[model samples]
Target: MDLHQLTIHQARDLLRKKEISSVELTKAVLARIESVENRVKAVVTLSAERALEDAGKADKALASGENGYLRGIPCLIKDNMCTRGLRTTCSSKMLENFIPPYNATVVEKLEARGMVLLGKTNMDEFAMGSSTENSAFFPTHNPWDIERVPGGSSGGSAAAVAADEAIYTLGSDTGGSIRQPAGFCNVVGLKPTYGRVSRFGLVAFASSLDQIGPLTKDVRDCALVLNAIAGYDPRDSTSVDCPVPDYTQALVPDLKGLRLGVPKEYFVEGMQTEIRDSIHAAIKKLEELGAEIDWDVSLPSTRFALSVYYIIAPSEASANLARYDGVKYGFSYENASSIWDALEKTRQFGFGPEVKRRIMLGTYALSAGYYDAYYLKAQKVRTLIRREFDEAFKKYDALITPTSPTVPFKIGEKADDPMQMYLSDVCTLPVNIAGIPGLSVPAGLPGGLPAGMQILGKHFSEETLLRIGYAYEQATEWHRQKPPLN
Candidate 1:
């Protein structure tokens, strides 16, 4: 049996029945990584030693009749999330040599559940860009076509799962970092409501907009991972105090009498014809399954969501990234005569162009003379975006849209065009603005490239979105199709 291809639920049953051991599974996964890492460039640090150790523990636990969903599962972690003693570079030279003494809250949770860490995957520097090409180490290529990008930030995690290098992986979503990549890679990625999962150990990008989520092979795995990570932590001031439901319970095939909204604003121009056709077909399938599709839904503020996200996300990022000065924990510039010079040199040498660009934009927006004109105005517009979602949710169970306007473009296709690159997240920014939940389920391929059908839901309403996505996923064969990487 190909152990690397087993989903969490499938693997758990085998482990429970003693049909397979965690060590064997881990070996199979590691071998797959070895075979594909060079071509895909998905992983940065491979924790082979640590993975084997954890797999042994899981095997012993299973031998002693101890069973857990993730106890014996091998998975990958995005580099931005701190992993104690493991290098978490965030795909930047800034922290290349820095090792955290602690694990992110999500990492700690996964470890507690018996998951084996397979090493950290690559990402855009500090999760700032739409394509993984911005990584300081190297850009992760799409497993489908090496010439194409795997989508940004969480691209490595998505590519690894698509290539079966890992059962599943964790990714952070700040303005579609998780979902967009998942969409491009033809996987399931969920961006939970902001604060539904603790951000205590996450390397911050945009604190208010940042969310940790799962990039999984299927919707069921997405739920299983979400059940393990969703909860409140006192350490995170933004953590929401709410009960996390058993997300697996939402896998029902029924969508009868459910009300779904389709905001006209999301179906904007410049969307590829194939993507549009696929989404329309998906909506039709949902209707046939008894979901009432409200085509008249309009979120007027949606037009401004991308602009608001750019302004507000950078502002928050500016504040969160201030600690990376030369004197602190990350990279530092030596041989400087003064502290000011040292700070200047460190930041100049440490941050990549994209990171520095955002910092400057944020600083400018938050400057004394322009704070009200830009930052404050963006916040007010952000509120309107949230209100729009709230009003829509009052009457609909969830909203549907294309995950990205286009399929994965060739690597370097938009590298020189910053505005074009930012457009990748245009359809997904509103969910973050409203602090709501969104899931990108693999929709049928358009022009042979994977597209995603995004389901948006109310705050903490992940169950409903999961139910909708699961039903759609079950109705189609998109999730089962593998990229032609081998």
Candidate 2:
């Protein structure tokens, strides 16, 4: 068997049986990376040396009978998460060489559990775009069809898993970054409820909306990764202090008696035909699996989510990103005549077009007079959106929809049109706006690209989402369909 293609659970069983060593597994993964990294451009920094050393340590530990689920497994992380000594560039030129002095909380947690770190994957510069094309480095190609995008800004992480470059990978989602890419690449991606995972060392995009989660080959593997990373951290003031259940316990094969709502608003007009059919088929499948289906559920406030997200996220981003003024860390303009010139040039030379666009939008929204008119108004709508989901959950266990409105479009298809690109996330922005947990599972391959069924649940209701996702996954062959990469 190709070791790189094995799931985390499969690899775990073999390692514990003394059938395969972590070093060998790691090498297989690294070799896979070497063979495809050029074509896919999925990785930003490859840490083969560090990965081998970590694998060697894991092997010794496993020899002593250590059986941590991730002990001997190798995985990739989105470059936005700080990894001590390794560059966490956010695929941007500004912080191209800005290595963090400390590892992000999630990184520390994974390492503490004996997970082998393969390296950092690429992302849209500062996680700003719907396609990975915004990366200051290079666009990460979809493994399914290199001419198409894998989705972004977690594009690299999703592409890596689909290509079998690593067993699994971590991704951050502000508004569908994880799930959109997961759908595009035919994998499973989860965005835990805000604060479900620590973001202490994460390079902030939109603080209120950003949450780190995993993109994995299947629902069970997603559960395993969530079990390892979901928890509160003292460093993150927003991190929730709650008990994390063994997510594996939630992965039962049926969704019997669970009430699932199908939001009418989510099936917006102009959506691709295959996408609509796929989601409808998913809803039908859920009904067959014993879920009580609510076909006309309406989240009225959802109509305003896109506008609210753009305003609020950019406002937060403008505030959060104010630190990169060329005086502190990251890239600086040395030829500037003075501090003001240096600050101006640093951002001008460092940030990509998308990043600058968002920054400017945010700056304008947060400006003194516009604050109440734009940012405040958006927050009011955000609360309404959240309340709508809250009321829906009173009658439903989870809500279902399509993750992306369309399959992975060809690269550069939406590049020149920012509005069209932003609309790519129309279905998913509501989940983040409500600060709820959402999961995207491969639903079907339409027109040779993948469409995903998005499962959205109440805050901290990840287990329920996983239960529903796991059930749907096991009953279908979608997750088993590999991309035509090889």
Candidate 3:
């Protein structure tokens, strides 16, 4: 395998055995980026020089007998997270030149482990769109087929991994941003329970729904990355101060006694037949591994997830994004005739169409006369959705569904139709609404396009989800199949 294609554990083993230097591995990855980045366009900022320097330091530490699972590994992250001295544009012109003064909590933890940072990946502007097409710079293409989107707003993160641009990448999921893209690109993506990971440095899209997780080559790598980043942070008020288990321990190859449920609602009438068939195959495979399959389960309130998510997420986004005024550190319109005009022009020109649309939707939802009708009602229904999941968990260990209703679509397939684009995440937004954990793993290739099996669990049940994902990954050859990059 190419050095860039090595999984985290594979690289760790080689690095420990002194068979490959960190510099060699880092260079291989950088070279891979140089070769295919033009075709994939998954990267936003490339920190080649700094990454090499960090790799050199890691090599010296290894020579001195120091050890760490990720010490010499290099990776990329979605551009939305704060990285000190590095541009974190979130694929938006508003913060095109913005450099954070301090690192996000997760970045700090990775740095502490001596992990090399390859740089930042692209995303939907302010993470508002389902396709990376909404990026202010360029759309990220799927490695499987360049004409198709990789999925978003974490498209670049998943695409980079799919294209072997990085060993693994970090992506934030609000409404299927990570999982949908992972499904499209054929990777392992997990959205941990809302408070399981710290959000101190994540640029907020929807504060209550956003959670950062890993996009990896396989389920084991997902667990390894999660072990490194999942923990409580006093810096984030919403962060839960719970103990984070070593996720690697949950990688048992059997589902022996677990009860995995399949909600019928997820198998919608109009979903692509390929996805529906692939998920059924995954169910059969899990059953072979000894998992008790509850083939007919109900989470009826899930039908309203897209609606509730649209209202609640945008409402939170409107408030969270208000900080990007012209007067602050972001883009400023120097020629504006007045303060309000400057603010208006700065945002007007800085944000993309999707961002503006969501902001308007959110603002309207929270407006004086509409609050009780739209925002309040959505929150109330959000409770109903969560309650339904809560009730389901009482009878089952985990829930299963397709990560998305369809495979990767053409770059502009749904770009002009907002509702069609919104429907892309129908299988996933409910997890965010319920604030639980969800894992997306490659199940099969339908029409030569990837389909993901999403495993959902109760809050803080990431270990169970990881266990389930790992078992599925081991039993199937799907994750082992790399994209053809056609």
In candidate 1, which residue ranges exceed 4 Å CA deviation?
A: none
> All predictions: root-mean-square deviation over Cα?
0.9, 0.8, 0.8
For each candidate, give its TM-score against the true structure.
0.99, 0.99, 0.99
lDDT per model, in order? 0.92, 0.93, 0.94
Compute the lDDT of residue 56 as modeled in candidate 1.
97
Instruction: Write one digit per residue (lDDT tens) for candidate 1, span 48-131.
Output: 999999999999988887877999899999999999999999998899988999989999999999989999999999999988
> Where is model 1 poorest over a 10-residue stretch in terms of lDDT?
321-330
TM match of model 2 to true structure: 0.99
Model 3 lDDT per residue over 1-486, tens place: 789999999999999999999999999999999999999999999999999999999999999999989999999999999999999999999999999999999999999999899999999999888889999999999999999999999999999999999999999999999999999999999999999899999999999899999999999899999999988899998989999898999999999999989999999978999899999999999999999999999888988999999999999999998998977688888799988998899989988899999999999999999999999999999999999999999999999999999989999999999999999999999999999999999999988899999999999999999999998888889998888753
Candidate achieving higher lDDT, 1 or 2: 2
Candidate 2 C-alpha lDDT tens digits along 299-355: 888889999999998889988888999776999999999889999999999999999
Give me the overall lDDT of model 3: 0.94
Clashes of each: 0, 0, 0
Look at candidate 3 and give me any clashing residue pairs: none
TM-score of 1: 0.99
